[model samples]
Target: MAEILFPALFVLLALGVPVAFAMAISVFVALSFGSSYPSLVVVKEMFTGLDSFPLLAVPFFILAAEIMTGGAVTLAILRLAQSLVGHLKGGLGHANVLSSAMFAGISGSALADAAGPGSMMIKMMEKGGYDRPYAGALTMASAVVGPIIPPSITMIIYAMQDQHVSVGSLFMAGVLPGLLITGLVMAANARVSHLRGYVSGEAMPPLAEILRIAVYAVPALLLILLIVGGIRFGIFTPTEASVIAVFYALVVGMFVYRSLRIRDLPAIILRAALVAGAVLLILGAARAFAWVLIIEGLPQFLAQTIISWDLSPIVFLLAVNLLLLVFGLFMDPLPGVMILVPILAPISLALGIDPNHFAILVIVNLTFGLCTPPVGSLIFVVASTANLRPSALIREMPPFFLALAAALLLITFVPVLSTWLPGVSGF
Candidate 1:
């Protein structure tokens, strides 16, 4: 059963089925044909998987992002980022990266970041005399930061998989690494600017103009600090924080920015529903697939095999990174988390690896996959939204990939990068 199950799953995936449906089909076939257990367990487990409260955050966070992105927020963020960095060498590139990071704080979904501010940045950078492919690559790269930051839908799903990890700790664990990725992006932008001989952005705006932009952008940016601070202070669970995010986005969009029309709510909810429903469906399907693996003793067998190797924690972590990088290359992070976390997380704990640290490493690995070639969803998103071929973006991905690799290494070897904030916050 073990041998036949996984190979069949991959074969189906390689045949171009959607990940969720592929997983369901593979498991259903394996169980009905090979296992002694009744196949009906698959439906039971899939329903059980969707029966999670923390999972509720997925839609709210997505809705909050849609609402904020529905109006003036993206423009304000672009203006603020441009005002602050647009005069630097590669300043437009810098603004593009910076704007995505800000949008990440609101959205926590790479696709949203890519489709929203990322598309805008690509056009903005192109208008500033930057190459189209370069702009697209940077947009996809920066959007990867979305799931690595606080209020992440990915982290929330990961928590549901591993009960030892609370959502708040995972939320706090992401802060430092997210900031590190931000810095790496800017550094990469500066290097590309010099090497490619891109022209500088517009002249540095006056300080008053900068101040005005920042002041106007304050309400939009405040959502980040509010979500983080509220979670850290124990004022709300990650689920509740998501609700606050929605209310805040609504108020700012309708009242402050005045860019969101009252009539727009239905469309916004529908969009969020489509995205959220897809995620939840994948999650349910993956859960059933995971149930098959557990009943087959695949996770335990693998865990014992690794333990018998007596690999040091450092070596083990490096191995895990390599493996996850490969997993990430072909898969979306949602199914990636649902499938891999259940199998690998307990092994890390057995090795005395910090679970929070391991979680961050896995999260970061899957996030970077969003920018990878072939199966990377965000790569396609950036290309279509920016009106370029996928090949164009692939040719420009190396520098950004290296920058992200560097940040991932820093987070992996430095456990404190993920643990410190969680510790201080009493988690």
Candidate 2:
């Protein structure tokens, strides 16, 4: 059953079926082909998978991101990051990183970061003398930060997978790592820019201009602070924070920014709905796939095999990182989370790994896959937007990928990096 199930899914994926439907087909094949179980389980499990209060955050965050993106909040963020960092060596790249980080907190999605600010950043960097592929590389690298920051949909899905972790704790756990990636990428950008002569040598926006940009961006920025602070302080649940984010985005866009008009909302809402619908469908399918594993006892079987190896926690983490990196290259993180967490989380816990630490490691590693080759959707998004080649993007990605490797190692080895903030928050 296992052999028939897993291979059929991959074969279908290779044959161009969507991930969600691939998962659904796999569920049916695994269960119905065997007399041990019935195919009726597929529909039930997929529906049960999405029936959750916490998962409500998914659509709300997508809606909020779409609203903010449509309102030019990303441009405001780019201007602020540019005014602040656009004078340094590789300043445009640095600004790209900074802008993506800011948008990360708002969007909680790598795709949104790539499609929104990321495309604009690539254009800016290209005009500033950066290589186009290099610019796309940096943009792709920075976009991963979106899922690592607060209000992350990936983290929320993870929390739902294991009741031991909460959305708030996971959100808090991501902050330092997000900042850590930001610093590492910026340093790498600066060094490479110096060697490659990619520095823009542009003048900084004046203090007055910077201040004006800051003032204009404050309301947009406040939404992040509200979500982070509210969750950390126990003022609201992460799901509630997502709701607040939507309302706040609407207010800021219509009144403060005056960029999101009332008439503009139908298109924005429709866009958000489509993205959210796709995500939920994938999540539902993943849940059903996971259920198939549970019914077959595959997780216990896999866990026992791992335990039989008597591996240390660090060694297991290293092995997990390698697997996730490969998976990320081909699979989207949503289904990856759904399918793997059930199998892997139990093993990690038995190995005495902190759930928060392991969760962060898994999330960050998979998020970076968005920047990698083959199935990296974000790579295609940026490449399509910038008219750059994936091959050239791959060639230009070494420095940034190395920086990401360093960040991943830091988070993997120093479990404290992922756990400390959650602990400090009293999680």
Candidate 3:
């Protein structure tokens, strides 16, 4: 049964368990020899894989990023990304990668951009002297641009597991790989904020305080350019562009940034419905352990063991970028892209590739496993909001995880950097 169901759910997730109860004990140990199915078809495929209607765009983009980070549009996009990169040369490490690419467009949640602008850019890079574990390792490497931008709740659980792929063409193929990993982590955070001196100098604010922080961050960057230009011009369908980004963040948080009051809307809609009911109960127990690994064929025994190793779609996408960077340093990118993107999307479409460029190279190698150590959820949310010591923010995130594993090996063998804007939006 697919070798005793994914090695007993990777040995109960290496004994720590709890990846949604190790995907319901690997879908009841791969339906323990189904004699004509029905052990109630594993409780009706774990509640019909979260009974999706475009997975209600993952709790209205997690309650419109908890009502636009509960106030004045995340400190007016951190004072317009500190008046356009604070004053350069490591100006709070280029204002912590330009306020994490404008709070990864209104908090798509890399643990809320590593505990909200990585705990205020690691206490303003330790009151400007820096080195609090390299400002908690560049705010956990610009909190992996909160799941690579575009109002992403991991692209709404990868467009509710392929409804012919179009959460606005996977948010326009994550906008130039989230602006090329935010310009390669703000030019490696302005060269380690000018090699450790960690520059501070502030001034540049006035142009009427950068036009009143660009008119209160142009109504939250025009609700992320009208939900990625109304889902790239077709007008709307990332669940109707997440119900027009939760009624444009509730008409700009209750009448233009009044800071959303009605008793803070029922604890921000019950903390975004308890994190979208624990990510739709781990996307309905990893879709009944990916329908028992596609009824046990295991993607044609992994495409005949990679066509008996006659490799060369550039060495099979460089060994599938070292097996998705060792399954993103031990799983979490939406149940490892809902259990290895339909077994590596038919082995990268039988090596021709381009299933939306192998689903943006398996979500930029699962954001390089969130920043690897013992499972790096954005370096354990910037080492528990900068109190520090997830191995001292993994020695300040190994050179921003080696510039995000060299832009995930050049966007995994450059399928034109994720199929050139999903082929100019005509998907």
RMSD values for the candidates in order, in angstroms, are 1.3, 1.4, 19.0
Clashing pairs in 2: none
Clashing pairs in 1: none
Predicted candidate 2 versus true structure: per-residue lDDT over 118-161, tens digit per residue: 89888888888888999898988899999999879999999888
Candidate 3 lDDT, 184-257, residue by residue in tens: 87788778777766676877777987887788788877777888887778777778877778888888888987
Summarize candidate 1's per-residue lDDT along 1-427 as a digit string, tens digits. 7677788878987888888888888888888788777878878989999888878888899899889996489999999999999899999888888888888888888898889988988887888888999999999888888998877999999998887788888988998999899899889989989998887847999999999999999999899889988987889988899999999999999899999988999999999999988988899998998888887888888999999999999999999999989998777888889888988898899899888999999999988888886689898888889889999999998999899999989998899999998899888
For model 2, the superposed segments whose C-alpha errors exceed 4 Å read none
Residue 396 Cα positional deviation in candidate 1, in Å, after optimal superposition: 0.7
Instruction: Quote each prediction's TM-score.
Output: 0.97, 0.97, 0.37
State in Å the error of residue 104, model 2.
0.4
lDDT of each: 0.88, 0.89, 0.78
Could you tell me which 10 consecutive residues in candidate 1 have the lowest summed lDDT? 1-10
Show where candidate 3 strays beyond 4 Å: 1-7, 11-25, 33-47, 59-79, 88-94, 105-136, 139-141, 144-195, 200-203, 207-209, 222-241, 246-329, 333-369, 374-393, 397-427
Task: Report the poorest 10 consecutive residues by lDDT, candidate 3.
Answer: 29-38
Candidate 2 lDDT (Cα, 0 to 1): 0.89
